[model samples]
Target chain A: DAGVTQSPTHLIKTRGQQVTLRCSPKSGHDTVSWYQQALGQGPQFIFQYYEEEERQRGNFPDRFSGHQFPNYSSELNVNALLLGDSALYLCASSPVGGADEKLFFGSGTQLSVL
Target chain B: AQSVTQPDIHITVSEGASLELRCNYSYGATPYLFWYVQSPGQGLQLLLKYFSGDTLVQGIKGFEAEFKRSQSSFNLRKPSVHWSDAAEYFCAVAPDISGGYNKLIFGAGTRLAVHP
Candidate 1:
């Protein structure tokens, strides 16, 4: 089965613009989580979606939001982006909602805010 | 607050040499821990994870990590390294399912360089 997959492998946007990244969870997985990884930094949790509702969110601001579809696909939307938003945004999927569940990650969308 | 810390910013070792990467975490309860590796321009891959049962957990890529609750550590180790192992390694932690969401707290990450 295919692992978690993300769309638009790379993206470029201007400061103050908006951008959207998409993700499809791994086969047989229902929970999707989004992460942002800055240069030389580890992935930071952005939020999580389960059952078509956002179950949890990180310390990020309202400008960052996400939605999970009934099919387990997800989308991350960032508004009024800043140059600091340039980074790799990753999507991870797990089979279960438990804390001990193993996560499978997608290659990620490299967003470059100019 | 749950948090993860990887003390090493970068490490360089000769191929075939033993390697170790340090990790530390702070959580209210017994935390779930994980080690992931990311190659250049690639996404993170799970190396291994620790829950309750074993103190030592073996992972893919010939990697392993030992969980030490007393020290709040889960350091990743490999007996011998290969040049292809050059990548960035991250340590992460999460609260028990009872806490909900399974959101992860990740460290800054350690970049490993294997020199032939």
Candidate 2:
């Protein structure tokens, strides 16, 4: 009955550096999605992964990539991070077969780019 | 392209007073709508959602939302407000097409401040 969980609650990196954030989906969930929430703004969709493959993506650039493991866990990697990338990286999970099902979210990893 | 809009950037109300947050969306067809609340330094928690049926949907914390297709709006309402209700509320919509993988487009958000 565990909810979605994310690692490295906070991270700090310099421009041009890369970082990887991790997320574990909720119990009995098979789909995982990532989002970026800027200060004073809502979360923006990054991408979604299901069955170890990316199913859908948002308007983000290719620098923002993700992977889904067999256990339904997920990782978001950003290459050549820019100062604008500093934000709260959120992870959300939902069960498959239900398109409009509610999503469970993790506290999110706060990324700070210098 | 689907998008959500929360008109109110911030609102303040008495603890015992009623509350409502306005939300509008732009989409070609009916989209899955949702309302989420996020406390300071926390994640967004789903309050309620409208998928296919029932224009009026009930959610936790006595929060409810009404979906109006004509207006392309989904507004969240609560009969009374609590001090703990002070938080940021977000409105989101997701496409329901076959390729939909629960990718949601969110509004900027409405920050609620409750006074004693």
Candidate 3:
């Protein structure tokens, strides 16, 4: 089966601009989560979406938001991007009940905010 | 708050030698632990996980991890290292929350280098 897939493998945005990254979860998975991996750092949780609703969010600001579709696909939107927003945006997915412990990840979209 | 810490920022080992990467976590109750490996330009791949049961867990790779509750640590080990095993390793922990959705707290990660 195909693993989780993310769109726009790489993206470039300017400060104060907005960007949206897309993700399609692995086959037979329902929940999707987003993470940010900065240079020389591990991935940090951004938020999670389940059943077309946002279930949990991390310490991120309001500028970071996400949506889950019926097909289990997800989109991560960042508004008013800052230079620090430049990082690898990773999309992970898991089954309904095992949303936390059993996760599969996508290659991730490299966001470069200029 | 739950958190994970990987002590080594970088480690270099010769091919065919044994390898060990240290990981420590802080949590109130029993925590779920995991080890993930990431290659350049690739997503993080799950190596193994520890929820309950056996303290010694074997992963897809020639990798294994020992969970020590007493030390609050879970260290990854491999009997022999391969050049292709050179990559970044991450340790993560998840809180035993009521809801099914729990965010993972990841360590800064350890970079492994293998010398042939």
Docking class of 3: medium
* Fraction of native A-B contacts kept, per candidate: 0.73, 0.80, 0.73
Candidate 3 segments exceeding 4 Å error: A99-101
Find the 10 residues in a row with the least total lDDT in model 3 chain B. B94-103
The C-alpha RMSD of each candidate to the native structure, in angstroms, is 1.6, 1.3, 1.4
lDDT of model 3, residue B89: 97
Predicted candidate 2 versus true structure: per-residue lDDT over A1-114, tens digit per residue: 778999999999999999999999988899999999999999999998989999899899999999999999999999999999999999999986764478899999999999
Candidate 1: tens digits of C-alpha lDDT, residues B1-116: 77788999999999999999999998867778889899886778889988789899999999999999899999999999999999999998876455443588899999999889
For the second chain, the TM-scores of the candidates in order are: 0.94, 0.96, 0.95
TM-score of chain A of each: 0.95, 0.96, 0.96
Error (Å) of candidate 1 at residue B57 is 1.2
In model 1, what are the clashing residue pairs, if there are any?
A: none
Best by lDDT: 2
DockQ of each: 0.70, 0.78, 0.72
Error of 3 at B114 (Å): 0.3
Candidate 2, residue A21: the lDDT equals 100
**What does the lDDT come to for candidate 1?**
0.90
Estimate the TM-score of every prediction: 0.95, 0.97, 0.97
Stretches off by above 4 angstroms in model 2 are none
